[model samples]
Target: MNILIAGATGKTGARLTRQLDEAGHHPVAMVRESSDTSVLPHGVETRQADLTDLADDVCEGADVVVFAAGSGGDTSEEMTDKVDRDGAKALIDRAKAKGVSRFVMLSSIGAGDPDPESDLAHYLEAKHAADEHLKASGLDYVIVRPVALTEEDGQRDMTIGDGVDPEGKAHRGDVAAVLARAVDDDLLLNRVVELESR
Candidate 1:
């Protein structure tokens, strides 16, 4: 399987690329031209493309796409909307255009119902919009909403459901493992699952 990771330079994306490699799958790191790819695993393939205006050919041979891109903490809400919402939607459209089979979105725990009064409400709103778009895209998709991310090693034991505590934490590696699993799991097709460490 040729797995394309949109934010392959990020912590979770980097971890995911390596996990996919370990699982004997090809991990294609799709990154911005300005992104530093030195952190990616050896022998991993790379494609230069920005999420905001991705070209259709970027996904030409991809079997699956994992949208892990984001506008990071320092960016404005507009940037969030552009990347997390619009950029994600663009990736979905491109995936379908390129005959990609599955899409796994790395969303946040509160993205299902964003809180208007929270400090991160804008980010959550952007993620909610992207999630909604993916749900309606008529493609095989899995929305993985993980709780607060921790740097601890992956335990590989996680609780999956909507009612899980939003405040619960999960290791980035564990989230990456789940994303890797979703890529080939037929049971996860069209499923929207929230993840948290047990």
Candidate 2:
């Protein structure tokens, strides 16, 4: 299967690309710039791309597209809305237009709850809004909502089941790996699932 990863420069994105290669899958990574991902599996394909305005024909071609894009911590709420929420929405729309079969999204866990008073709340609100959009979109989609993220280097230690609530922190590596698998055959038809460490 050919998998396209947006925001492939992120913490989980890089590791996920490697795992995809190990599983004998084609990994197409999209990034704004180049980086050490050069050492990624020889099978991995990297492209200079921005997900903000995705083209339906381009996005629809992927067997699966994982949206791991995000605005960094230094960004403001307004930026979060543009990058995280709006950017995500654009990707979904394009994927649907392209007739893509699967879409895996990385959304923050707290996004489900509504709280816009705090600074960080703005980002969560935006994420939540994006989540809603994806849910309503007519595409096969899986939205992984993780809690506070940690840069722990390890495989996924948690097995999140149905009704699982992403209310706590999980390693970015873990999240990435799970999202990749979801895009693969085992969970191919699964619609949506949230993940977090216990």
Q: Candidate 2, which ten residues in sequence have the lowest lDDT sum?
A: 184-193
lDDT of 2: 0.76
Q: For this target, which candidate reaches the highest TM-score against the unseen true structure?
A: 1
Candidate 2, residues 36-148, lDDT tens digits: the string is: 56646665777666665555555645888888878888987778888899988888887787777888888876677867675578788888888888888877878787767
Clashing pairs in 1: none
Q: lDDT at 170 for candidate 2?
A: 80
The whole-model lDDT of each prediction reads 0.91, 0.76
The collision pairs in model 2 are 60-98
The TM-score that candidate 1 achieves is 0.97
Each candidate: RMSD: 1.1, 2.5
